[model samples]
Target: MSHRFLAKQWSLIYVRDVLRVLVARDFKLRYKRSVLGIAWSLLVPLAQLAVMYIVFKEILRLTIPHYTSFLLAGILPWIWFQSSLITSSMTIVENRELVKQVGFPIAVLPTVTVLSQMIHFLLALPILAVFLLIDGLRPTLALVALPLVILVQFALTVSLAYIVATLQVKFRDTQYLVGICLLLFSYLTPVFWDFSGIPEPFYSIFMLNPMACLLTAYRAILLHGQLPAAKPLAALAVLSSMVLSSGCIVFLRARDRFVEEL
Candidate 1:
């Protein structure tokens, strides 16, 4: 029942082509009637960033140097994860007809959702770059490590997406639960504020969250022009790998039941 055994076998392998097709089809279907096409994905995050910048910098007078830059480091990735999860949570259920009509891999559901959002994040990078320039910040060579940060983020977000999608299919309350959890977790993480705001005992605990490590490193490289300290980077590497491995296991376990449930 592992299916892991058949992963490479032609008959059992979930070919990459299948995933590509699903992603392509889903992306087109997503923006079909929209004038903006795929641009909508980046637009939402950009709009949110503008609102936050106006409120925090103008109204609250909370002047953090390179404030918008600091936020871009957090917000783009946050939107990617949040957006993907929100859309993916119902992917299987929404594609119920496809599930019964096609015998293809059910695991493709979450991957396709994540890929579409990834495309959006890529488009928004120029917008983030503009904020960095306005803050008089020039990215260092360490900026190349942006891909590594994205790699860690993808590992965590996709894994969570897979687990959530399956759970949402079985338990309708899962979406509401995820919304509440995301609300608390975003605040708990240093997305809007800095680590200075977190209390003593909580500091060590909160750092254990991968998002903490990712955002912290992103800020360091983009703003400070130095590499992320070894400890946090290592922690995220360990955490991301574990989550990715487990996500695959969890997806395989539920996929069979998904087709039946559909």
Candidate 2:
């Protein structure tokens, strides 16, 4: 039993090390030829914020108070979700060499994609903080809830990543379909707009989207300086847990056949 326990512990450590290496490799390859390097993480969101501000505030004439803060809270998280899903969808196919290795943790490919994008999200938060300060939204004890919110979003993204990655292995079109779905989801989610104006069934429908709930929680904590509603947040956590379990099962079962497909 003791020998078995030690072996299990060592296996976990090996997986951890492999995950770390893959994530680092992704980060380097992502920005390797770039001049701005990691600064692109900060800049990309800001650029998106600028476009959103122009479209919503300037063109659509939205009168949202502290609109910059509102937009940043939404855009930063959404970008992380969008980028992770798209990239992870292709991760297994892109790393056919690694997937060919026997006993490899195939799930780590999608996980690495999600985590690397998450780091980008965290890096952009300071910019959001600056905007929040500019808008006079002082830091509150509500800030303490931010990490929990991040963890919930992380779980949700990683779960979806696993599902999409598995699908992409079998169906090459999965990447394009995911891209189109994400495009629709961006508008469906309140990334550039507030859901308050949305009426009954629509509001209820939007809430059904986990990303909608996650974004709402983010806006509440960062912009409004408070915790999100308990019921929805708890529901999201539960839903994410279920999806993750399902995703892992699907990925593991499909993995043995992956080599044949590839």
Tell me, by lDDT, which candidate is best: 2
lDDT of each: 0.81, 0.90
Query: Model 2, 1-262: lDDT tens per residue?
Result: 2335434544878889998999999889989999989998888889989998999899999989999999999999999999999999999999999989856777788999999999999888888889999999998898888899899999999999999999998888999999999998898898988888878998999899998999999889887888888899899999999999999999988988999999
In candidate 2, list every pair of residues with a backbone clash.
none
RMSD of each: 2.6, 2.7
Q: Could you tell me the TM-score of candidate 1?
A: 0.89
Q: Pick by TM-score: which candidate is best? A: 2
Candidate 1 lDDT, 148-201, residue by residue in tens: 888778878888898898788789988888888888889877776778566889
What residue pairs clash in candidate 1, if any at all?
A: none
Model 1, residue 77: C-alpha shift (Å):
0.5
Tell me the TM-score of each prediction against the true structure: 0.89, 0.94
